[model samples]
Target chain A: MIQLRNALDVFTLVMLIVTIVLLIYTMSVMLMQRGKGKTPTNPKVVTKVRCVQNDYSAERDFSKGDYVGLEIGKCPKCGDTLKVEAIYAVGGPKEKDQPL
Target chain B: MDAGSSSDTWYLILLLMFAISFILNFTDIPQRIQLWRFASYIRRRLIQMDEIESDVRRRLINYLGKLNINSPKDVVDNFMNNYFLIEPVDIEPIDIIKRLSHLINVRDTNVKTYAERYMPGIQKSERYNAIVALEIASAINLVNKVLKHYFKLGLKNNNWVLLMQLALEMPNIIRIVNSYSKALDAFFSGTPIGDGAGPLLVRYLVGNSEPKRIAEDTVYYETLINGRRVYAIKAEGPGANVGKPGEAVEKLVDMLGGNVSRIVTVDAALKLEIEDTGEVAEGVGAAIGDIGPEKIGIERAATKYGIPLDAVVIKMSLEEAINTMTKEVYDGVLKAFERVKNTINSVGEGGSIIVIGVGNTVGVL
Candidate 1:
């Protein structure tokens, strides 16, 4: 049965409501951010190899000291040289279309 | 008390509250409050920028220490403070590209001299990497200094608008600096960066053929693609450098005596916000991203020889361009390679085409 005696009571009530709303807003924002999670900081990079003589290509996890123009070995398919075609990082931040 | 008396008290108190608020609004107090909030937020970002700058500086010093520099700190500080370029005037617009080209060359020579001064006997490749690392450190330092200057200015002037603008820009600034930090690792390890797409494609095209030095920090290989003589050019690599590809192309056309049929330039282009990474785009212009010297070099060569110029670009974000090459961009480069071959095939058989891979040639040979 509480009633507003003066403007102070009314002001207190308004502040209480505003504080609750802000708390809820902050909590939801935090939860949303947490759900989004962080993108992979260091993605796994791999090197792709291809045999110039045939339709044979292979990929392996990137090793240190790997460079383009490196001749790995002979290809199994056509027995021609398997050279490193590309070395690139994979699996970073996802595309915008994908849902979190 | 009765409801009537309670209502009267409520009205009186409300009037008092309104008076207080109205008086405060007329004063600078409200703006001061907003200023404080924005200032605190910007202060946090400035601290982050400071940490990043310090970390880069520390890494650079450590790297130089390993290189046996007598005073790594002094050298790094000197480099961070002194490495700058005064762009040539463009108001007259006459031979501006030539002036820019000369300035760029002088800047390159100065940077090389600084690198050699500290590490005299280091391998050229190692020296190139050191120069890249120094540039990165200097860049971070520059960003920190600029931001700090504005931040202090804003606070001193009580300029909330300036502070707010800076606060809004903080995220992108942080993102860019973080990417630069990541690029440091790639450079330190000599890993190929995304910008190397052009050079990587050139290496694929050239195979194991020997490369003749064509220009300062640039090389070219004479090879055949689809029965056409293809002179593949790229910045000399396994080091972090973007050689003067434009000058190389100009010299190459002169050497060939205007016999070149077409010139195709491949480079990494910044993608639109909605564009997918690794998208390949074809256009008509020099693909090189230079102030003026490089792009115009390709253009002048093509114009002089009456050779058609074709540009194939691989799309990537700014961050991706500087960081390690991403799979998406690598695939795009492969696609561009095929596209280049197709463009070359369009020229008559036995015709000559100059393909310039225009990008930072790092970790590619």
Candidate 2:
């Protein structure tokens, strides 16, 4: 019974320390990003290219994880005159065009 | 005795944690190295993209300079817009004219607009696009080669989750890159892609140059569907074109004197991971593409004319959509044809219908 109690206590202490370390690491990364004045990386950036003259347009509504490239299309604002070019993934994994 | 035992337990636990930390240090060293390597691969792709952009810009300067201009943002912009388009398949001459007409016009307008401001008497020349298209083709090839190299490196690292993620996403990554490569192939060759399927299918099935030029860059062949006079409208093909079926459909309704019975759109659709490639599905509305410009045209025209629109899709992976058309996809098209015939019959015999094929016609006869 005594040995069991000691093992449980050790586990609890180890877990608490782990939690604290993780919390601190995350906080440091966030602080560093703020210091650099860089927007945190977005994983959802998508880039679509189209000729604007044909009324063909792409929509990148800024969904939380989506990043669309060079924002030109037949949207109400971009009109059908501007063609979108490139997209930036901004530090993401396998950032490529996702078909709409 | 109890106090002594407790103290020993605390000491042992402290040592255990320190030992764990020591072990982690060794494991983390390899992971850290892998992270750096992964970063290196990403950096390489970015550099390639940058190099392509620089080369394009340089080429643009040369082209514009030949026209006696220091700068032309509109022409450059237009060039960039069309330059990025990767046509995987060949496009027809008329279809290419149809597909690129907008970009050509925009650039022409830009040139005219800019000529008024910067370099007067700058003629709108097709030669500029031809030269740039070749450059863009090489650029896409380089970029794709880099992306392939980037994804391949992921396999070397076993313990890194990020690398594993990249490996898993490799198929999709290659899919997009392949799309660009194929688009380049189509653009440089001036051939309409298989995505021009709608137009090509109509042309192929219609089997003649006699297809009536119905709309701007659109055409139709008259046939009977279920004993009803069916007018099949698609973009005119034998070239790279997504013929404006939207406008063609509208024209059909006008020719029929309004109150068309039904509209059936046949095109390729993307299949999910769970679905089989080359599968056939029947649904409502535009099964055309993600962009709604064409869909909107069809839907509005259908709604306005009070017609029931049906979409028959030949299932294909996005990879297949951008890559060359596979036998399976072609077979699916054959199957889709049967469905189209059935759809016409089911909608009602002796009723006028319009069948529109939607997709890029890269390698379909």
TM-score of each: 0.90, 0.52
- TM-score, B chain, candidate 1? 0.95
Candidate 1, CAPRI quality class derived from DockQ: acceptable
Give me the displacement of residue B235 in model 1, in angstroms.
0.5
lDDT (Cα, tens digit) per residue for candidate 1, span A8-59: 5787899999999999999999999797666555678788888887589988
Residue-level lDDT tens digits of model 2 in B231-306: 7876543333455777677777877887578888888777876677668888898767834346767887888878
- Taking the tens digit of each residue's C-alpha lDDT, what string does model 2 give over A1-100? 5775777778899999999999999999999868755543533333334544435545342232111122333556545444332221223222234555
True contacts kept of 2: 0.00
Candidate 2 displacement at residue B101 in angstroms: 14
The candidate maximizing TM-score is: 1
